[model samples]
Target chain A: MARMKFLCDAERCIECNSCVTACKNEHEVPWGVNRRRVVTLNDGVPGEKSISVACMHCTDAPCAAVCPVDCFYTTDDGIVLHDKDLCIGCGYCFYACPFGAPQYPQQSAFGVRGKMDKCTFCAGGPLADNSNKEYEKYGRNRIAEGKLPLCAEMCSTKALLAGDGDMIADIYRQRVLKRGGRPQTWGWESAYGASG
Target chain B: MKTLVSTMAGLTLLFLGGCYESPNVTTYEPGVYKGPKDPLMMGKADQRAETLKKRFELVQMDR
Candidate 1:
């Protein structure tokens, strides 16, 4: 089984935010829930770059490890999914996530954080494949449908690449070589560190 | 007494196995911005808001 991943080339990203929009639309994500976001680094500077951020679906996902109810689970393709039914509305996953991905809708009322929601990597949730319930709660299960994420496909500049880890990395490497920009070590260092 | 010792040993292993090491990633620390101006800055600060609005509109249509 291939380990799925998403790689956003900061050098190639035009900050158009097509990825963010695609994610929200595909999922019908609520007003306060952002499945994807663009973070502009060195804004208004020479090296101004915007990277689309979402759940990275890590090898040893902290969210999955920290979930008290064990709602989160990793698929063969490395997509992290969770059962909304099993979620206890605990905010541990939110705190454990490095990318600030997990979001709780009930945070506004009574100071109680709701069940955590994050990117499903277009694979939907723990619900049965292609079910309406899964679509309503998570989003489209494009992976099961033999398709990639809509965000990467909708990217006008082709900045966000999603597929097998090696394929996406190769795409990013080619872009970096063509653009004459060195790859930044920040992503892995920030995500898992040297020991990881 | 033998059963009690084994139970204690099992509990210790369970607790030790669950321990996770923290990564060295920088936490989000809020602070005041004090930076020099950039001459090459091309757009207005409000551009982000405008872009976000357009993105939201696109998302609304997809749903």
Candidate 2:
């Protein structure tokens, strides 16, 4: 089975924030919660590189490791998912996650963080595939329809690539090879002179 | 493996002793997930031509 993955090619990324918007709109994610975000390395700089960030769904997820309730589970495709029913809203996953992917909706009166929510890789939850219940909590199941993550699909520059790991690695590698080397990366000309 | 073997043995003994009417245990094979298909898988790809076409369509995205 293909190890499902996402790779944002910094070279092609334009920091459009389309991926973020796509995620929110598709999932109807609650207010004050962003499943995906754009992080630019050098703010306001001419040659800044930005990559859309979210739950990387690591091989051995730290969130799973730290979750006291054991809500987290990884799919065969390596997409990490959590059961809201099993979650205790403890925020341990939040602290354990390296990318700050876990989010809690501000629903309670006294600033109580609600159930942990994060990027589901557009795969929804443990419920039946493409079910309305799954859609209510998670987002659309584009994967069920044989499509990639909506974030990657909505990417204007095709910079945010999502699919099997090996396939995307090859794509990114070919792009690099096509450019002849890594020095001619994105914004290289804007950062330095256009002499190669 | 030892724990699993012991658990299975205990379950078998319980069944044989008639103390356990119906066990709700679910034994799963290793290296496979048998949960509800949330975001189900598409069948595998056959060749690069399809990939190239898909990439082209995405790259042509004007939005």
Candidate 3:
């Protein structure tokens, strides 16, 4: 059983929105909702870095912790997912999440908020795997189809590695070793913890 | 006769409204649309092999 994980190498990322576009295209995400995006730090400076951003699917996910309706759950493979039907459109998860992953599609008059949407790790929601309900509410179920997340797969430079945590870690570790430098994984410590 | 015809017309409008279909009810089996396969997909096996080979080549270069 692979413990799915995502590692974005800032050294290699060229600020291309290919990963962001791949995710949106694969899921047919709504116009207002972005399941994934690229965030660049430092503008017009020497050695600027950008990394694709989405739900980190944290080991101890704060989004799950803050959901008052108990809509969130982690899959066996460690993918963090939430039940849109059960979700009450509360923005608690959004405030709690460090990555600002959870997004609401509609904010109508009179304090109305639609269901919260976030990265599904391509595993999908509680709805039947690859079902229409799942696709409409969540996105693609590539994980159930024996495929990794499209964002990483569609990466042009292979900067984003997605697969078994152990496997990709080894790959990343080797690259860092060859380059002869400290492993500067930007969000790893914040998402997975410093020791993790 | 006027009351009878008016009642009948009202009932017919009610029936038509009930029969109206909603567009939001979409099904996956017939409705799911897939785009073209990614040609750059080196496939899963190839992706794994490529990563592993790169790791080993790095180690060899280090040695």
Candidate 4:
């Protein structure tokens, strides 16, 4: 199975936030609970750019590592999912995640966070494939349906790309070669560690 | 019995004082977002552009 991934082209991203709206509409994500968002750097600056941010579905996901009940799991396609039932409302995943992907409802009076939620890469969760349980917990199983993530598909500038890692990397490489740009050195190294 | 009660009380105070250290990686500096050129010593302009290109590739592959 091909490892799934997401790539956001900062150069091409107009920060239109079409991807963010598409994801929210597709998932019915509650207010204050955005599964995807556009983060702008150097807002109002001449060279400002916006990059759509969400779960990268990393190979060595930090959230998965810190989950107390082993709620998190990775699929053959490289999507990271979790068992909501098994979650214990711990916020370790939230603190550990570099992308700020994990989110929890403020259900408790003392601010005891609720079960963690994040991007499922549109593949849903540990619940049975395409079952009502899965849909109820994780918006949709688009990957199982052989469909790409709604965010990437709805991207206005085609700035957000998602799919097989090799293919995505190649596409990015081509763009860089064409534009005479160099690779970023911070995020992947800091989040995943230099060894990666 | 008195000593035991005092010890318990002390422990409770320590725990309830929000002094319990978390096991999670606490080295993270919240509200401090890092950019591509922030560390790794790469050229700022080129790094940002490259990072964007990488992100684009990921999205494109799924297409």
- The lDDT of each candidate is 0.72, 0.77, 0.75, 0.72
True C-alpha contacts between chains kept, each model in order: 0.00, 0.16, 0.00, 0.07
Fraction of native contacts, model 2 = 0.16
Best by DockQ: 2
Identify the superior model by TM-score, candidate 1 or candidate 2.
2
**Stretches of candidate 4 above 4 Å error?**
A183-196, B1-63
**Model 3 misplaced regions, further than 4 Å:** A183-196, B1-63
Model 1 error, position B32 (Å): 43
Q: Roughly what TM-score does model 4 have, to 2 decimal places?
A: 0.70
lDDT for A193 in candidate 1 is 77
- Local accuracy of candidate 2 as per-residue lDDT tens digits, A89-159: 99998999999999999987998988899999877888877889989988787665556688887777888
Worst 10 residues of 4 chain A by lDDT: A181-190
Q: Which consecutive 10 residues in model 2 chain B have the weakest lDDT in total? A: B40-49
Q: For residue A149, give model 4's deviation from the true position in Å.
A: 0.5
DockQ score of the complex predicted as candidate 2: 0.11
- Cα lDDT of candidate 2 equals 0.77
Evaluate residue B8 in candidate 3 and report its C-alpha lDDT on the 0 to 100 scale. 98
Query: What C-alpha RMSD separates each model from the true structure?
Result: 17.7, 10.2, 11.5, 14.2
Q: What are the clashing pairs of model 3?
A: none
Q: How much DockQ does model 4 earn?
A: 0.04
Q: What is the two-chain DockQ of model 3?
A: 0.02
RMSD of 3: 11.5
Please provide, for model 4 over B1-63, each residue's C-alpha lDDT reduced to its tens digit, 9 standing for 90 to 100: 999999999989988988667788657443222211111112243433344345445454434
